[model samples]
Target: MALPSFFVTAGRRWLKLALALGGAAIAQTIPAHAAQPAAPATIRLDYLHTGNATVEQYAVERVVIEPLPWPGNMARTVDDTDRGVNLVEVVDKASGKLLYSRGFSTVFNEWRTTPEAEKTNRGFEESVRFPKPEHAVTVRILKRDENNAFTLAWSTELDPDAPDVLRKQEPSALRPIPIRVSGPSPDKVDLLILGDGYTAGEMKKFEATARRMADQLFAVSPFRERAKDFNVWALAAPTPASGVSRPSTGVHHASRLGTRYDIFGSERYVLATDNRALRELAQNAPYEFIEILVNNDTYGGGGIFGQFSTAAANSDWAKYLFIHEFGHHFAGLADEYYTSPAVYQPSGTRIEPWEPNATALRDPANLKWKKFVAPGTALPTAWPKAEFEAYSRDIQQQRVALRKQQRPESEMSALFKRELAHEEELFSRAPERRTVGAFEGANYEAKGYYRPQMQCLMFDRSEQFCTVCQDAISTIIDLYSRPAQR
Candidate 1:
């Protein structure tokens, strides 16, 4: 993921200019950042992504010079892992040489799949961040075409020294609490735990919850093995209320990040669409990833790759929620479950999915995760799909009824526990449970799409990731943090 070394001398020259402009003034505002070697200043490009189901467009918003230095390893400035729905390339304008690149997904793209997009157009604010380059750069946004190949969607020219660039930002009263410090910012994966719907008086509780969630996340595989390569920070802007909005229940609260449930009419879904507010709060901390904790007890959460994830901090299944959603946000792992209703409409033609875990089984001879498949394992691996789906249908019905009756959160939690137990017993008996072959019924469809295993965190409330998911996560971990010394 390293950027080409040829631009080192030029990068350093702009790094100095970045420091002079506003980096020096904002130094005192940074919290718990260990002293490290000089790095380039962070530049963010904000824009409006407007579209409907059939068409989309991108327009430039103002550019901003963030308060912090680039928190990623300078050596690993480019992203080779093609995981997200969109890819960004930063190229030197005059030389046309690639300087930096990354893969990420946006709320706008996700919305395009929903039925609402077919009915009416909508716009979402989005942003992309990278290190400041020495020369004028052309920022190109590439999106997946019909065949899942990255095609240029939009491109814009940027000049760092332009007078219109936002060079200064007002200081934030909130200070990020260092939850876990591994090393200098540039050397480790920086994860910012932002809290929404917590009052000023509940800041201590927010920190405790953030720390607990971080511990839970690392307890899972891959992350547990690479725990030392991460730095975790917690921050929250005090809100007047103690919980985020849940429109289905007619409950609403004013929160800093605008996180809430009932996104796209799915009662369990939660997300924050305010990109500006999210970036403004996150800029205070040195972060490459973010997970927002809402101070509510509802079993709701959501994640978008390379952007952020949110979890209901007080939910009984908070641990599962934190890890499962992170799989989507951190590594672009698609959901393996299909019985539950989703906000997105089903695709008429099931081409191969861009996610690492889910596949359309287009080419059985060259399945992406074929290396992990056993020699004699069948291509379309067999499992108790019928039994599992039948049970899931009943459980889903009960789940919907609970929300319809406005049942207590405790009832919802109990129902989930029962569902998990039944799935465990059902999947354990299948001979193919431990096999790594194509399992039918995944990615929100009961047919076409396939998953690598019978069970996984992406598939259900399982405790561990499937082999394919584990490898995918490890790839991302390596991208953000250096490998452990031999």
Candidate 2:
């Protein structure tokens, strides 16, 4: 019914600043308008997701009552956007009414597509959180079948009042500092920025980096235009070491979050494998979205929709990495570039992807973004594909050689700058540079899949989101916060 008292007790300076900005204070947990009902207690279900490419299984580990109240808008409890590889649905047991539902992708789903999944079975920890219900409910996880339609994969009945449910927990040593407090949590999108691999001496640096990244996120639209619809909170636990593990480089260090580079053996792919450690620390704050900042200067980051996104806080291109990876985590936008090597094996069959950006273009007449297409524009829009691929191939080789040679991070950063310059020059001369039409080479394939534009943040290091991507992101913003006034 109230914000955890530690928020005020542990961060006095931030509390005072929040109050000065007329943001909600700890004592004023509810909105000033008393008519709004208090948010329900937050409930988290921890589970183990295990399997290989051929088979999978899910099992409930435990249910927890998070310290903070639910931060989501009660008015909009069901997700209609239809993104992600899996969906979580909570149904009232007695009446069979759907009380809450959300779509999310997991590390397991990403892993299953890799070659390793074919050889051996492995497991990943996963968690789903919702507002606690008064009575028994059926929690079902639906997975996409071969046809890309949702099919029930696992289900369990849960009772919130059960004696085994964890109703309390020890207070976390880390306390959330209010970075940008727009309003009450339920009325705004609460984004929690977490820091990993920062020592006690570097906590101040971590906060500054988190603040900078949050600012970078809002500098882009529609986040820029709808900035008032969100709140930002930051928290970090001190680590014994200063940087996270980069196994490929033979550098290893322990951190509160088990985040490390060389995920799936890709040098620049960073991710936290320990989901339970992440969830435990995050429960201390009221958050709907999370972005983890790792204390490393390497060019690496990873994101999974509805889980979390990670960015290198000390990279030369940290701002771009932060916003670019956040695009995947925040809106379920697929990667548009294809030249870079990835861990996942190519799919033999092309099914229409559920992500908002890329498409198989199976039905050109009814392209998902047809409304944005110009009247006479070609379905598979023309672009300089041949030339672009030729150039990208050379750049990819240089990128690989730099990492293989153990070159300095600055050299890699310089190469990226040059690559972006070439891309911009190439795109400028193209006839359909600004056109909203299907461009070949997307979703990590040189053919079959198409993106909506010639260049976008998802496609390259460019700063702007494509028109189609902007629309997709706005839809999600509206779902979590109040819709824009007509």
Best by TM-score: 2
lDDT of 1 by residue, 49-77 (tens): 99899999999988998987777777777
lDDT of each: 0.87, 0.88
Ten-residue stretch with the least lDDT total in model 2: 4-13
What lDDT score is found at residue 245 in candidate 1?
96
List TM-scores for all candidates, in order.
Answer: 0.93, 0.94
RMSD of each: 4.2, 4.4
Candidate 2 global TM-score: 0.94
Question: Which pairs clash inside model 2?
Answer: none
Model 2 spans > 4 angstroms off: 1-34, 484-486
- Number of backbone clashes in candidate 2: 0
Candidate 2 residues 103-134, lDDT tens each? 99999999999989999999999999998887
